[model samples]
Target: MKNNLKKNKEISKEQIKNYFTKSVSNFRNNFIIISLSILKNFRTYVYVILIPIAFLMIYSWYTNAYKGDFKPPELFKYMVIPSFAIIFLVNTTVSEWKNSVFLKRIHSAGISRINFFVSLYIFNFLLGIASFLISVTVMSIISLIYFKPSNGTFFSLLGLLEFNDWVGMLYSLFLCISISVSIGVIISGLINSIALSQSITLIFVLFSIVFSDCFLPIDLLSLSKPLTYMSYFVPHKHSVWVGLISASSQEVSWAFENPERPGRIISFGFNLWIPCVTAFLYSTLLLVSGYFSFGWNTKK
Candidate 1:
């Protein structure tokens, strides 16, 4: 009896190891497969989306140059990068689901549903980071070539490139992108039609921008107590606040205040780390929700 018990323990240990090993293998294979799909269709993506946005960014900078310095436009700040990242990811996910034939094939091949969702999330998250880097690099080059600070100080662009601040800013951006990607995945997984999914995601992106403090100042929320409380729920508000604060050590009170408009003067006493943590938590929550909510079968 003792010998049999010992043998059972040994078998259990081997089973645990095998389970972990298989999980890792599934994750790796799924990630690689999705990544390869993105690369294979690179040109279609570039022409359809990337190139047009790049030109729009350039034009935005050029127009700003005429007005004063060559700081990136507000559109670039609050919309372009985040919107593009979300759209790209959500589209990719929904497309896969929409392709019934492909979905049936993959299901027949016995791929784990959890692995598929995780791999898709990771692919989009990494791709979002890459897109952010490319956008930053392009803007920096444009600044170098065309931008001239009115005061002959590089402070405008310096905030973006400074190491310590840049690290914080990058973290904030990553959190934002991660949140966006997770939300996209959730939307795509829940919705059945590809076009409908895209439309819903687009509306969500627009709503986030319009309602969030990114375009509208937090001070605007002061007009209504309920609205002010609601603004706290907006993900971009935290991200934008963290990003602006991280970019400069100087009090960012100016960003939230407008003397001409005449509103309540709120103090900038909030800790920067709060938003960073909040955004991360939000992303994790969305990812877990998407994983569970995602359907294994192709039929809605």
Candidate 2:
């Protein structure tokens, strides 16, 4: 009996080790497949990336031409970065869903749904970061040559910022991308039609742009009580505010408060810990939802 028990324990341990080993190998293979697939269609990425760079350049030119007090490049970074990430991620994910042959091939090769979902998520997140970095680099060059920040303040892209400020900007940017990528996955799983998915994604992007507190503060808008309350659910508001505030060297002129809804307020000054925490929590919730929503039946 003792010998049999010992043998059973050894077998269990071996099985556990093999399970983990196979899972890791599968994950690596899935990641490679996802990377190759995404990179193979690099043209789409190039076009998508160029749109924002062009917009930033033109906006910077206009702001410089008009001598606006706000820095166009820095201000737009919050919206542009997340918008690019969302559009690219959602489109690619939906396209992947539309590719039935590819999904079947991977599944037949022993790639589990979880592995595919996670691999796609990581690859898309990294790609999103790369695209944003490229955009920022180009915008920094434009800012240096054609655009000057108001009052000789430092540029957000390539400026001599303090360590904390850099941390704040990076955190905000990554938070935005994380949230965008997760939501993209969830949307792709929910909407199998590529065109429909892209259309809804575009609508989402437009909504975020119009109401993200970038063009104008949400608190200032004379929205109805329910609409005003719903506006708080928009994750972009917190991320954009954090990024813009961190990037700015001068005092924020607007009062970050809602007169009607006193509870909805981004407190004055650089005390950004709360907003960061809030954004992080929201992203976490989205990620959990994405995990459950991803890997659904594409046929449906």
Among these predicted structures, which one has the highest TM-score? 2
TM-score of 2: 0.80
User: Clashing pairs in model 1?
Assistant: none
* Candidate 2 overall lDDT versus native: 0.64
RMSD of each: 4.0, 4.2
Which runs in model 1 stand beyond 4 Å of their true positions?
42-44, 47-52, 55-84, 151-156, 159-164, 215-229, 254-262, 265-269, 298-300
**Model 2, runs deviating above 4 Å:** 1-5, 61-66, 70-83, 149-160, 215-229, 248-271
User: CA lDDT of each candidate?
Assistant: 0.61, 0.64
lDDT of 1: 0.61
Q: Pick the candidate with the highest lDDT.
A: 2
What local lDDT does model 2 show for residue 7? 100
For candidate 2, write residues 1-300 as lDDT tens digits.
Answer: 999999999999999999999999998988897777767776546644766676566656644633644343245453344344455555555466455677777777777778788887787778667767777667556545654454353254335455766677778778777778887877787787777887887788667755665444434543445555565578765676566566553234332333345444433233566667788898899888988877635765
